[model samples]
Structures are given as structure tokens and as C-alpha cells.
Target: MTEIPMGPELLSPGQSCLATVEQLLDFDFDIPAFQRPYDWSDKQVSELIDDLSDAQRKEVHLFLGLVVVCTQSNGRFAIVDGQQRLTTLMLAIGALGGTGKILRPKGGGVSSLWISPRHADIGFAKALVSTSSETEQTLSQRRLKQAFSKLSDQKALNLATLLGAQLIVYVAPSLAGATGLFERINLRGKDVSQFDLVKNKLIEWAAVEKDSIVRGEIEDFITARYDTLYRRLDPSSKEEPFDSDKLLRVHWILFTQKQFKSSDKVLTEVDSAIDETYSSKKSIARWIESYLDSLVRVAETWVAVERPYEATPPSWAPQLKHALLDFARLGRDGELQPLMVAAIIRWQADATDLVRFCEITSFRSALAKKNSNHGRSYKWRVARQLYQGTWSDALKQPISLAADAVHQLFWANTPYWSQGEAREFGEDLTLEQVGAEVFPDNALDSTRFYKDYRHLIHYFFWKYGVYLQHSKEWADFTRIDISPFQDSVWFGNEERFKGWDIEHIYPQTPADRDTREGRAHLKVMTQWVDHLGNLTVLPVPDNRGMQNLPFIEKLAWLREQKKVPFNELLATPDYRGNLLNKPHWGINNCKRRITEIRTAAAKLWGFDAVRELGVGPYDNRLESYQEDIEEEGGDVPDNSAETVAA
Candidate 1:
């Protein structure tokens, strides 16, 4: 092994040099104490191999990027970056039957690299080199084996030549300088995520602990929670899963009740907050405990926000869970998440009231945010104040406070609109008023109801279907039932909305019938083609099977299937004389059919009161809301149903 002199000349930061892989790997590399295990999965390793092999095939020199290293006085070097590439190179060379140990240092006593210095056995490379079959191979190890399989003798020799002659590395003067450079480069690039930095800080603190017991416990905590948190934060990523920085900001809001404006400052802000609050060691210990608890709370809160219906509805807080499901169905927004976390923590028992308050607040706030003329400070200010209180303390205040706050905020911000004008208000109406206004008996008159507010169709079905199924008269519900409707889609082994389709009562077929009577019938069907009266929900298979069939034939098929609640409701004999029973369903029958259905819905939802509250000029507010959400990288649920041909 050739020893390159490291002197004052090479001690400068950002010093550039051209060195072969053999020359670079000569000095033993240390994988610093704070670093995570070698986690480059098989796919990544294979890509590196393929890239190098392709370079060899094309006879092009491949420059493997900077391997930032900190030179130690003991003639060894600590790798600060590009360890995955270096390690994979060694593995590939080893598979090629190279016994020279050119990848490792001179003394057989020590190898080329020290992975996780104090915890050598904890990394993937150690498991690979060790003869112990008991060692649990990680994804990277499996990939190493797979990468080995891809290498033939000639290819391996070519790779060896490339490694010995082609690679370049940038070595910084000292370990501290190199570490700083590593951090800056990675933080500025995609190489390192905020999660990695935060993890390093925690583990670095753990490494400094005087007590072994405390250190071990912290290490164990990190091991248990690290990947779990990472996976939860980035559910989509299996390989380089790292999206928990936003989560840290959420933690900041939950703790401080204030927004952390800069995502990059999240770690520093959180650290400062912790340092300020927990100045003493004992306090810091307590903070760690509380921090772990917050991680769980925030993670669970996120899951609830995105997938409320996924969990078994909490039996003790079913109503709150139901309300959360509504929030989830409405849309998942990060700004709204803190309030939900607070609700779940404190006021979950009053789930119905809490959900109503949030629903009203969410609509008002979203509108305010969309209209840049109106500021969002008031919403955040009130949220901080409301969320800081305990459940009992929160409940002590008037339930109307939320509505009052929203109205007051809007009144102050939206000065363009008349302050006293009820016509400008949308969700500012009371829950009962909202229900009535949104689903009045006369709702059938509006053809716009079908395209807009499709989500409410499920809600209406849940309420009326449950009432009918329980043998409670619809009239009885109108007068006395104040209980919130639980979603029937969640009942039984039947998954919620798995097979449900939005079906048109009248199909959208052409009026191509040659005869006069047939032509009139076709025109009527076409006229009410998109009416909510003509729309109902059925299972996908049932809906598919009913395609372009005559209304009577479709009705007969629905009876056989008995899969859709709303369809089954329409099939019942008790609700005849309306559009459902017409021998030849025409436009008038369509209007009557929807009118009866709307009346039933109005009994539960209070549609007339909603109408009295006055509608907004933004009739397609949901469409705009959806567009804004999509623009912000949020997903809006597709609630569109299948339409029948006229």
C-alpha cells in the first residue's frame, strides 16, 4: 500500500484532488459515531454498478462524485460523504475474487473502513463481511448479493481498472471542517433530509451522555421510533423515505401554538424551544419524554386527518371519529390539522359539536386564505388561543364562540362585503341552518345539486337509510332526532365505498327513437340527465349491469341486487305515487321522485333553514376549493358517479 503524505499543504478546506478508488480507499475510513447504518437498498447499488459497467463498456471515464473525508493524524481518514458508493465498490471488488485487500488498509488488524465507529456490528457492511449466518441482512446486504450476481469476471476486472484509475475525491483538511462541509453540501442538496440532521443531533447528544444506561435507552428509543416515524412521514417511499420535517413543524405548532414559517428553520427552532423550556438536565429528560409523546400524538393526528375511516372507530368517541371521517372526506389540510389534534386530545367526547365547529371554521378560513385580500392572521391567532385550553376549560365557554370568532374575523377582514349582510355568509350559518339550507325540500329544483355536493349524497343516504332500516318513520326523524348520522358504508364486512358508484336516475342516452312517443320519452330523460333527483348511489357491479336499461328494468335489477341503500330506499313500496313508481318515468315524474327524496333528506338536514340563511355568489365554491387544493399538491376525492344514457 502506498502512503500519500498529508501535511500543511493538504490541510486547507475544499482542497481538490484527483485520486483513484484504490488510492482513496488506502487510508482506513471511519464512518463517524453519529452516522446511521449503511442503508443504500439493492436498487441503488445495482444502479451504481450498471452506471459504472456502462461507462466501462463505452470506454468513457466515470467520475464518481466527491467522497468528502476528514484526515486524521493517525494516517486514517474519516468518510463524511459518499460511503455508500465506496462500500459498494469494495463489495463488488471482493465478489471479483480480489484477495489483495487493496480496499482495506495495510494492517489486517483494521479494515479499510470503520462503520459506525463505536458500533461496528450495527451496520450492514459488518454483517456482510462476518461469517455468522445468524446476522440479519438488511436491504442493502441483499442488494450487495444481487449486485455480486450481476458482476462477471471480465466486468469485475473492468470495474477494478475503472476504480484504480478513474475515480476522484475531494478531501477537506480536518474532521470538524469536513463534517461542516458535509452538512452544508447535503443540507443544500437532496443527499440529506431534515429528518437525518435532526436524528444526528439527537444521537450526537446521546453519544455524549456520561451514563451508559441513559445512552443505551436513548439509542434503543431512536432505533424503535426512527424508521417507524420515517415510514409514517413518507408512506409512499420504501427506499429513501424521508418526509418527517413537516411533522417536526407540526410538533412545533402543537407545542408553541404558533406557526414556524421557515421549514429549514424547523430543527433550530425546535431545539431552541426545547433548550429554553428545558434548561436543566432533568428538565431535558422530561422534554425528551414529552417529545416522544408529541411524536406519537402528531403522527396519530395525521393518520386521523388523512384516513379517519381506516381505523376502527373509537367506541368511546365514535361521534368524534365520525366527525373526523367527515373532515377526512372533506379534505386533508395541514393548517386544519392542529385543531384536529387539539380536538382529539381534549374535546373528543363532544365530537359532534367539535366537528361542527371545525367544519365551519375550515370553510371560513379556506375562503379567507384563497382571497389574498383577506388576511389569515386572525385564524391562526384564534387557533392558538382555542387550542391552548383544556377540554373542560374549552367546554366551559359558549359553543357559539367559534362561529362568533369566524364571523368577527371575516367581518374585519372582508370589509369589501357588507358587515351586517347575511347574504355574504356561507358556512357561518348554524349547524341546523346549514343542514336545512344545503338540503331543503325544494333542493330538487336545482339541477346544479348533482354536480356539486356529491359527498352529501352519502350523508343523506346514511341518515334516511338508517332511519328506514330501524323502522323509524321519516316524520318522526324530522321532529325529534338530533343524533348525528353514523356512516352506513362502514357497517358489516363491506368496506366503506368499495363498490359504490354515483349512478344517474335517468341515463344520458341519445333521443334517437324514431317514433314520436319514444322521442318525447328520450327528451324527458335527457332534460333531467344531470339532476340530483335522477342521481343515486349503487354498487359498481350493479351500476355497470344497469347500463342504458329502461327505468323499470333498472329498478327490477336493483331489487335483485339490494346492494345500494339509496337504490333500495327508492325500491320500497312505502314511497310510491312519486317518481319511483311511475309506469313511464317522465320529466314530471323525475322532478317528483327527487322532490320526495329531497323532502326526506330535508327532514334530517334542515334544507329550508339553509335556504333562509342565504346562498353565496360562489355557487361553485367547492370547484374553486378543489382547484386550489390540487394546486397546493393536495388530493381531492373523486366522488363522481356513473351516469345512465338518456
Candidate 2:
């Protein structure tokens, strides 16, 4: 019998069969350009691999669930369902074995991947199949590289050869049929998320109650939400976005006051909550409606909160854009998300204060380090309180920062004020008393800070640039199409800054730097070279590592190339006066630059809050405070005393 022609073959409508990754590859599959990119988190990827290992030990065939595909105009299969699993299967092939042949649809086209990602990452995926590639990359590439390391070479090959995972392929003749099937199985059957589990129960109840309208609403609501949010959860996104499952889980926590104990636990909690709804005399239709309503409240805002530096400020709360960004950066483990979404919902009229409260509280938690697991222990409670209207509205206004709070941060190693002495109070604080304060390489000594403070440098400088841009707001920058936090642009890695990197105003290594034959003219500038003042965010090609080029040439080349973004460090008056007009850059210039940047840092951080913004150190963000309006106009105490210990 003639072998079926390679690549997509026309199959009868409704044809279905069990297939392995090997057999599945016979069809050339194309993910629509609009489909969500590869986004399995490190944990998710590891779990998939672990699941394979478990299957291997049991000597059982892995039965991964259904994959739905339909024919495209090019005759390649458009992946309508199971993209994550299919892509991961290819990734597994590329990892445990060479994908040189397996990656191609049929002919092993040099330009094609068996599963083509969005147009931009097609090459990156191909490079991934090859061995001895770059170890440091971001996004899908980084996660993929990490996934490749999970098994030993012999073990990987063993699993690749011996493990025959059975996947059910439901091949549809047309896109419309594929989409309908996708919505059904994707929502109802994919075990990756439990959204469909609770949803199915709701529909079942709806059917029993004969509530057809609400059932239809649930379907429409879920379809719309998933379609809109899928791409937003792309692993390449810098926003640390949530998958649709996490959104439902967070909503569960918000209403139930339960921790995300486990996937099984979530279903149990959801089931219990469903029982509670029924016992409370609430209609099943109303139970789901209420849950969906809460989802609607936070789902859109939840995503907007984590947008990177290039997106325009969201129109609903443009002023709170930086606050949202800062909050997103907090507890990068997602402890802040539930609280952030709840704040937007509860205090919709006062977006600024609520968003900033989340920002400041998240900062306080960061200061507390591991001691405060607000995400695991407290954020859920906070979110629940806000939802139930039990949390004091006083939290909607700024919490007064204690005077002692600002000094340790601004003054660095300075001695704390004596407990006996009465401390001054204010809406903010400043570094008016810095001369006597010094710590050995403490954070305040901007001259001493360098690459050791990478996170601080990137986050703050980008923030400072934002501050300068928006009439000195965010005390930060607001756009997120690219990032300024990274010192170098990573083309295909997660957490990359495609447009910016740290630029040393003075070449860190000039041709003359190593040619110091006699120590007559040059002092050991090693310590000062990486100082905070010497660096600023600059646009990329990185001009072939221009940090080594002669200073004057850098100015001319950069000016000619317009390698400077319009609103960041280049636009500052300090940039004009310090480097643009200077004929030479030396240790003194870096020293001079530090003072200006530190003053900005003092304000950008909470140090100079009172002097700069007329609010407490934690309240530098505008409109993030108001006079106490509680029944007694009581002062909301600052519970985050550990703010300076960090």
C-alpha cells in the first residue's frame, strides 16, 4: 500500500484515531498567528516531563488527551486544541532526541517547525532543536532550554524511544468544525486547567433547573474570556501574566478565603462552595452568575496590571499605571495579584490610592523578604476582605508612615533615632540628613552601587525615567513595549529588554583602559566604573558594545543613529549638562552624576517622600492619599515596620 503522502492529508470529516507524537507528525500543523505562543511555565514543563517519567516507570503507554486540528488554506493542519501539549511533545522530541528530522511537517523543511509558532519565533524554535545552543535566553527559549536539562542524555533518549504516548487526534475537515470542537474539549476536557470542571457543574445545574439563558451566558462568557486572555498569557509576556486557570483560582480565593492548596484541593474547595451556595438557598444559576460577575470585575484589570514598559497607560487609570507596574513587580510570585484586582474592584472610584497601596504594601513585603509571605498568607485574606466589604475603607487612603521608617533607608547605615526622642510625622520624608550617614556599600551610596545591584538599577532607572516623563509621576516610566531594566537586550529570552541596556557614559574599557603603561595619568577607576551615576538606559543594537568605544565617537554615532529613546535618560537636563556638554568622562563625572541620580532615587524610593510629594515616605505616588475620613478620622497605622531592614 502506498504510504499516505507526508504532511496534511485530506481526511474524512469526523475521522479520529489514537496516535503517538511520531505518528502525529505526519500532518503539518500550523498554529494560527493569533494563537497564544508557547507559555508552559518552568513548573508546568517539569510536570509534563515528570508525568512522562512516571509513565515510563509504570511501563504504561502515556495517554495524553485529545488534540483537535483542522485544514488551513495552505493544507497544513491549524492546531485548534492541545497546542501546549503538542508543542511540548515536539520540544520533548527536540530535547531527548534531535528534532532535525522530526521538526519538519514532512519534508523536514529548513524553514518549518512541525509545529510552527508565531511568525517571529519560528527560527528560535528551530535553533532549539539543535544542540550546544546558548544557555542564556528568555521566554519560550529559556523555558525550553531548562526543560531540555531535566533528564540525563541516556535517559532522555530512552524515554524518547521507548515511551509511546497515545494522543487522540480529532481531525476536522474545516476550521469552523475545529473551532467548535476546540471550544468543547479545550474547555471541557483539557486536564491542564480545572475551569471546565466547575463550569461543567454549573451547566449541569443550569440544565437541571431549566435555566437555558444563564447556561448560554456562561458559554458565551467563558469563550469570550478565553479568546481575549490566551495571547495575554503568552510566556514571552513580561507582565508575569496568569493563565485562565489562575484567574479562576484567584477568584475562588477572593470569595472563599482559601489558599490554592493544590489543583485537587481547588476542585474540592469549588465543590464545597457550590454546596454552600445550594444550602444558602441561592439558585445554581445565581451562584455561577455571581462567580462570573466577580470574574468580570477583575479579569480585565488583572491583566492590565502587569503590562510591560511599552504599553500606553491604561485609559481607566492612567495615573496609576506605574503603581500597577510596581505592584506587578512585587512578590513576582503573584502574591500581589489578588489584592491588586480586589483593590480595583472595591475602590473603583479611587484607583490611584488603591493601586499605590498595593504597590507600597508589596514593597513592604519585599523588604520583609521571606519573613512575610503576604501572597500565601495574607494577600488572599486581604482580597477576601475587600470583596466582602469587611476591610476598613481607611485602607483606601494612605497609611501614615512612621518617621523612623524613612531614615534607615535614606541614611543607609546611620544609627536609628533614640526611642526616647519624639519622632516627627509627615505625609512623606527626605534625605536632608545624609552627610553623617554612611554604610559600607549600603544601598544609599550610589557611587558604590554597580552590577551587584542589577535588579535595583534596572527597576529604579526605568522608574526614574518614567518619573521624569509623566510630569515626575511613577517617580517612574510608563510605556512597556520594551524594557529598560536589562543591561543588555536578549533577543529570544524571557525577561528581555529588546530596546535598552545599561550604557556606561564613560567607556568601562576604553582602548586606553588597558594601556596604562605608566600609572601617571590614570588612577585605578575600577570601583567607580560601574557606579550608578556612570550608567543610564540606552537604546539597543548596543552599537556593537559601544561601552568600549571612545567617548566622543559614542556621542557622534549615537546621535547619528538616534540610539537614544526620546523619554528616558537621554532626555534629562542632567544628560544634556553632564555628558553631552562634557569633553571628557572621568571618575569625577561619575561622582557628580551619582548625586543627581541619588536625589532622584531618594524620591523614587520612599526616602524623600515628604519633601518631594507632600506624603509619607510610602505615599510619594500622587492622589494616593487623602485626609482620614473614617467615622473617627482615625490614623491607619503602618504595620510594615520591617520596611528598612531590607
Per-residue error (Å), model 2, residue 253: 3.3
Off-target runs (Cα >4 Å) in candidate 2 are 1-191, 196-242, 257-265, 276-283, 308-317, 322-333, 360-376, 393-448, 466-496, 506-510, 517-523, 545-547, 550-584, 607-646
lDDT of each: 0.50, 0.52
What are the per-model C-alpha RMSD values against the true structure?
12.0, 13.0
Residue-level lDDT tens digits of model 2 in 1-646: 1233233454545677666666667777876653555667778876776778777778777788888876655867777678878777777777766566456544555457778866545666777676646543335555555565653243644545433887777777554456556656655544545654554444344444445565555545544544444544443434343456777777666666433432334656766767776788877656666666666655666656545343323466656665665654442446556666666665553555555544443343333232233224334543555555544322353322322222212221112221111133322223554444332223444444565555444555555655554545322322344543332332222353445567676666565555543131235455666777667666556555565665556666555553324233333445434533233455655655565555564455443342232233233332222221122213332232111100
Estimate candidate 2's alpha-carbon lDDT, on a 0 to 1 scale: 0.52
lDDT of 1 at 556: 77
